[model samples]
Target: MSFIPRRPPRHLLRLLVLLAVAALLYFYSAPVFNAAARSLIRVDAPAPADVVIALGGDARCMRERRAAEIFNRGLARHVIVSGVPYAWGVHTGDAAKRYVESLGVPAERITVLRDAWNTRREAMDVNELMRAQGWNRAILVTSPFHSRRAHYTFRRYAAEYTFISMPLEPEPPEWQPERWWSRRGDLGITVREYLSWINTLAGGWR
Candidate 1:
């Protein structure tokens, strides 16, 4: 007696293929997500501007350092530090001003705006300051993750002046984007940045 062999079910074949694909993705998705995480960074070329504004929340003082560098390079004539009070009630704008000053930025060249509690408020207040000062162009300095949103918010709120986005290059080890997912803090920052982007797109923080 001869026995007939039956073919495997189509659903089983499809499931096998899906499993193979999933395995491949699971093994090789690092670069893909790394690139996705890097997409949040937007650094524009440094250009001569009337002023360089460093947004607040930089405990590491990286943003202030960049502002001072830009000023020292003559890319901007003035440096504006914009931020609200810190946890200890010390104004971030004031702290940033001192940081940049210590970095060799002259005291006469620094202006501090302490009323901005968030990026949106920063943009508004900075724009008003620029308008009053007759400044028509600005360079924005911020951390890598915050650059894109900061630039977008500033441009949205302050449409009259030209704004350039410059994220801190060669970011500190703690904020490295090459493997942001490996560290809990970096991962949280990346996720929060995207969420902030959504908020920015939806008319920004109220």
Candidate 2:
């Protein structure tokens, strides 16, 4: 009787190498991606402010609803719905304001600015309004992915007042925060947001 050693299969070796590469990629990339996502989202609105600002572009009205909630909680004396017209020519700012008003916010306490076609312009418009109204701070509401860029843009334009950014939670079908890399749409969103942030830092907000 003779004892013989068996060689490992080539497929098994290939699989092990692939797994090592995957683990390395995950270890290096996951933290950076998660950091970017976390940085974009600001959940704490611990203090009150002069007004609640619902940023434009989100037709889902998620931010508007959050702003309404903040207003209901007496975190702000006013709500400024900021956005331009949507694809169907409906003024988003007015639409958001109407929605908030229907939620029990007083009409007088809500201001609709339909001239802000983009985030930079919205920041400028809100900044001017804040100056005119002598508002010292604002509770800024926006999507979780957009909050960081929105904060940067607003701060660039309105450095005089404080902006407490409140980001809406990532909703399913549009975003998956826990498994953000599982969908192409989420990857696109994450990349776009990061690029936008970079562009803002590069003076694109000007």
Candidate 3:
């Protein structure tokens, strides 16, 4: 007598398909997630402005470098470096000023604001500076991951002036947005920026 073979149960077949789909997503989701992460960045086209403000936090000085490039291009008449003191006691604002000046921006054209401990304070202080200087348009230079929130915060605090965001593009090798999750430092930066953005959206910008 010949034995008949039975097909697998419907529930078991469905479970197997679900597991396969989950595994596929787990392995192939990085690129999709990276694109989603990158959506937070906002870079405006280069345009003439009264001043370029470089928000400090980068030990690599990427923000200052971008500010200098904008100044050298004659897009901005002045450069403002805003930062708090570093852990070692040197004010990042002062350091940024020196760095930008070295890149051919005249020392007389650079102003350093060293008291702002965060982006909100920086916006407030820079607003005061812009008011005193009679500057109506400004460009904000910061890390790519920080551009969106930085622009939002500045607009919220300094609505009187036109603020353009110019995040560092072609980001440095150490902070490439693509495959950010593969590096610990890049992952931390990405995560922190997202959290900060959420906080900003929640009116937590203090």
Candidate 4:
């Protein structure tokens, strides 16, 4: 048998400590997942925007709910549903329309865009729609956690369009995470966002 030299006592202790920290990070990130998802998914009334924008993912639920609310409030004459569909069946647009219909928004008032491939695509698509259709302003609907990223992405894509956030605060916290820096998963999101920001700074490519 090959003589595998044993690790030193101090090294072994450090190894064990790292294992424990890895475990803590794994479990600790779940709370971040909860925080991000919880902050992102919401059910609420829509704020006033010339056009209502719903981003992809769980925010769809918020979009649908807010769409109906805004329609009823007469805040905006048009609602734009962004995101593409998967083969799994219900596309975001269809789902959004069904949701708004439940709230009594006429079919004519809702416009669904299954072609929006991403956040950048949605912003570009909506801006194009604004030019062709004469929509001067718009309300962007998304979850609270995502509001900042979504806004930055959209603002970059549609510089001419006036943007207003209609974020649905599902579990709006009284205070944000105090030790957020120690939270690795939270950092994961921020890191990803920072990388994106850096990429934008380099070229600002869509």
For all candidates in order, the CA lDDT equals: 0.86, 0.83, 0.87, 0.66
Worst 10 residues of 4 by lDDT: 170-179
Which tens-of-lDDT digit does each residue in 89-176 have in candidate 1?
6787787888888999989999998887789988999888988999999999888888888988888899998999987884565376
Residue 34 of candidate 3: its Cα lDDT? 83
State candidate 3's TM-score.
0.86
The candidate scoring highest on lDDT is 3
Q: After superposition, how far is residue 151 of candidate 2 from its true place, in Å?
A: 1.4
Tens-place lDDT per residue, model 2, 74-148, is 899999987776668677778888899999999999999878777888888988899999999998888888877
Query: How many steric clashes does model 2 contain?
Result: 0
Of the two candidates 1 and 4, the one with more favorable TM-score, higher being better, is: 1
Model 2, residue 155: what's the lDDT?
82
Between candidates 1 and 2, the TM-score winner: 1
CA lDDT for candidate 4? 0.66
**How are the candidates ranked when ordered by TM-score, highest leading?**
1, 3, 2, 4
Candidate 2: stretches off by over 4 Å: 1-23, 26-28, 87-89
TM-score for each prediction? 0.90, 0.82, 0.86, 0.64
Give the top-scoring candidate (TM-score): 1
Tell me how candidate 1 scores on lDDT. 0.86
Q: What's the TM for model 1?
A: 0.90
lDDT of 3 by residue, 1-206 (tens): 99899999999999999999999989989878789678878888878999999897877888898899999999999999877777786787788788999999999999999887888889999888989999999999988888888999999989899999988884555356788888898899888888887888898758
